[model samples]
Target: MSAKTNKGGAQAPLLGSKIKLHIEKLAIGGAGVARHEGVVVFVPQAAPNEEVLVEVSLVKKNYMEATLLEVLKPSPARREPPCPVASVCGGCNWQHITEIEQRKQKEQLVLETLKKFNPTLQFEYLPLKESPRSFRYRNRIQPKFKNNHFGFFARNSHDIVEITDCLITEEALTTKFSEVKIWAQGKNSKDLQRLEMYISEEGSVRYGLITDEDDGIGFSQVNRFQNEDLVQTALTWAGEDDYPHVLDLYAGAGNFTFPFAHKFKNAEITGVELNPKLVEKAKSKIKEKRMKYFLSDVESYMRRAVIGPEDLVVLDPPRAGASEYIMRALAAARPKRIIYISCHPVSLARDLNWIFAWSQKLGTPMKLARVQAFEMFPQTDHVETIAELRVDS
Candidate 1:
């Protein structure tokens, strides 16, 4: 074999070898993408546009993973992470990067993911929406309790990283950490008990255990500051067009459903959710006779419902995105407009691809009208995106 050739007659780098790489950009999981010997290397905690010295941690047939050892050159977007435990904790992955760069990366990633799925697609991509607050903005947080260790899980491990304060959490919630710690320590149960703390809509701070019988706040917007802008944007994009009904799928306590109902007073507002608790909550607030909340999965609801061409569908699904059946059904039904609020870009792109492909097959091609990324989550790789799809121009 030649000096640089492997047993398979292909060039491959030795594992545990130290190599210099120029980080071209950040990857989906908060890693820096660099190329070495025509193979991509993903280095954790590295910045884009920087030359970094990395140690090969793991090698694969096609790609390799590495650990950042030293920065030969730093990117302009690099910044000092404020969190003391950011490097060790799993709560955040992008805190070391600048806020401006974080949004830029998120925007680029969203578009890239979409393009990867729909190569020939073109849509009006809007400028990214920045979060109202970058730090101390999260109103809800879950701190673990095990042997009096009150904090989040460590990076790639179950071991709890003890923390008295979380930088992303609200000051009010952080102030209650001592009281919560004491409460957790007082518990006789030695097993780990997950705890929840959040500021309620009534302006009261509430804390409780996440029991098997009750899932504490299954889904919610951590950053309420940005949620206002998100809600307003969704409502505005939905527009004042009169439709027969406004259908909301995966509606958690009528977050967007109620707002859409409020705007379109003449249309029947129907919210479908699998979670019984959220459906109950949404039903309880039924002041309007036209508003209705159904306790069923989106797929199940769509199976029976006859979605008209004039109906407006607003779906805010989980990170997994809507199921394939739901997407295909929506494509066949061809609703007038679809406002999709997504948490994971890859899942969103996959779902969109399914819908568009199916619509094209059905001879009713729904076009992607607009898309915008929201910095709902700051100091982390997580991002929220809003996309609008319509049947006609």
Candidate 2:
């Protein structure tokens, strides 16, 4: 295969070249990172401290991507993946590595990424929180169905990887796989069938095709067991401050909103979510006059939000993370406490940088009190982090 540089319009001679590498560590995206000829090479399914043979696939100006040819020397954490389709499936990437190693790598990844973005930033780094169940913990999944195939997309490709069951998914959802396939067969469409299967809030398995008009049930924590602990951690970190107001930004179906309402009964709890369905779900459960749910994007809400020095803000933004304007607004508002729940570390680190930069500029400094990484999605590189921030008074 011919390799081409992503920039500079130059031909990459390393394309299709075979080389031996000692993987030093895993990168942010779960790729084993190694340096070859002074350029970083990223190989998927590689374990740290392992000697491996790889074939270079894509070459960029400063780095190259490779396919793992063979593991010459494997790390002790390396193990056989529990899933039969793990080799081809795109769902869980770190199944080849032991769970302990996965947690260790994840903890290191979060700390290193944060420090990389904010060099002098210091806060209490808590130990990684373990998931209640490493396997069978995923409560929701979006599987693809096409040409009688039912499974997830192939690694870096749109092609489907057929699988009878997913190891990372809970039994409640996995047991309905056959039934979902039968239901998909009734669709009778030749185009690639995109489907969503999840254990609903009612504890029943639900499945359906994803259409352009709708994005399915929307964002909710996939690991039910881990979510309980995550919610408690956020509440605990936020503390029992007698703030007059509480804000749950990016609130979905009142996951944290209702809990915050219960914890701070006197505080007026407000939730802002763009999805009308989630907003409706949240509003329907409102029991007190102090609770309010709005259907608006967080950036717009932050623009009009009346934040004060003693208010607590709990924001669980999506993977893309919150915007700069919102971060600047929060820094200016200088809430007494802010609990940020992030699923992506790079974005989280970037957002924190924004907050600190704005805080310094506005002369209302905010300090990171403590941060903890949660193993929300085990057998995958995805991690959930909760951070507490306080006004530097």
Candidate 3:
């Protein structure tokens, strides 16, 4: 095939164009939404109710992407970022926006995405749950060591932005910065080295290099404080009603499965996971004989297994959301209740649309019961949400 991009790599018609616009609201993927000449524009590092001068960086057919050049009118929710390297670091995108505003943006984005998908759908929209510690809540971080510059990569670039401390990380992990630097220097390798630092289960600081063959531990919730609240919210939304069986899909290390097992002592909990490491960890904590975990992808597991009306389903899918096949299968199974926990609102909304559309086509419709957003990651646009759906009588 021909070269991937144009000669200068302009995706659409309007590259290197500058425009002034009023940001109406925050959109998914951590950007402020604006409209220019009937075309949607997305500006990063911007806040709602703000006027900004932006330069068009990437242009698509329907939407355009812009970089915030100057904030002509700053929003009341804007604040000074605590970290000195916040502007460059790729970790936190909404640090310039206030914590309260960060949550507001997340809630609005989640609601907007869901509404855009299904306008007629109705559900209870609860207030966004805020994290206990906005800063210093992150327990795990991947800091790069290269050419005597040790820190995170800059936004959209491989260049490293050196920093002494990351304010978002926990004190336990930040305190080991000195030791980490020493360990990197002792290696004396010129190439880039990826290192992961986190607080272990026993409350000890641990650091290790990431090799090509051995990637560090699988995906785990970084903010433990907010994670607890998320679990509680999921459990509460699940309600006290008893179901004979609970099926946890995309279960990561039994984060939701364990608590669900405890909450429903009479229910048989079955967790489906693809990662062997996470499956192994989740299996080691098996105290009850009623709980079972399978090492398989959710789509693959749903293919052979059958879900009945007496069972409840709990799904905590990754950012990509559940597959269309799985959603269709769940609709066909017609479970009693489904508690969906999502990290990305766009995918969650799309998945809901698929399930509802399939259920409608199959003549067994599902109704949305409850929904709430969780501000699990502070100083950023990422959000966790729990949605409850039940089969219509």
Best lDDT among the predictions, by candidate number = 2
- Model 3's alpha-carbon lDDT is 0.89
Question: How many residue pairs of model 2 clash at the backbone?
Answer: 0
The residue ranges of model 2 lying beyond 4 angstroms of the native Cα positions read: 1-11
Candidate order by lDDT, decreasing, is 2, 1, 3
Positional deviation of residue 257's Cα in model 1 after best superposition, in angstroms: 0.6
lDDT of 1 by residue, 1-393 (tens): 112547874435457788899999988888999988778889989988998988888877778898999999999988889999999999999998999999999999999999999888889999999998999999999889898789999988889999989999999899999999888888878998899999988978899899889789767778999999999999999988998999999999999998898899999999999888888888999998899889998888988988999999999999889988999999999999999999999999999999998998999999999999999989988989999999854
Instruction: Give the clashing pairs for model 1.
Output: none
Clash count per candidate: 0, 0, 0
**Candidate 2 lDDT over residue span 311-346, tens digit each:** 999999999999999999999999999999999999
Q: In model 1, what lDDT does residue 53 have?
A: 89
Give me the overall lDDT of model 1: 0.90
- Per-residue CA lDDT of candidate 3, range 49-109, in tens? 9999998898886778899999999989877888888888999999999987888888888
Question: Which residue window of length 10 is worst by lDDT in model 1?
Answer: 1-10
In Å, residue 255's CA in model 2 sits off its true spot by 0.9
Q: Assess the local accuracy of residue 156 in candidate 1 as a C-alpha lDDT between 0 and 100.
A: 83
Model 1 regions more than 4 Å off = 1-13
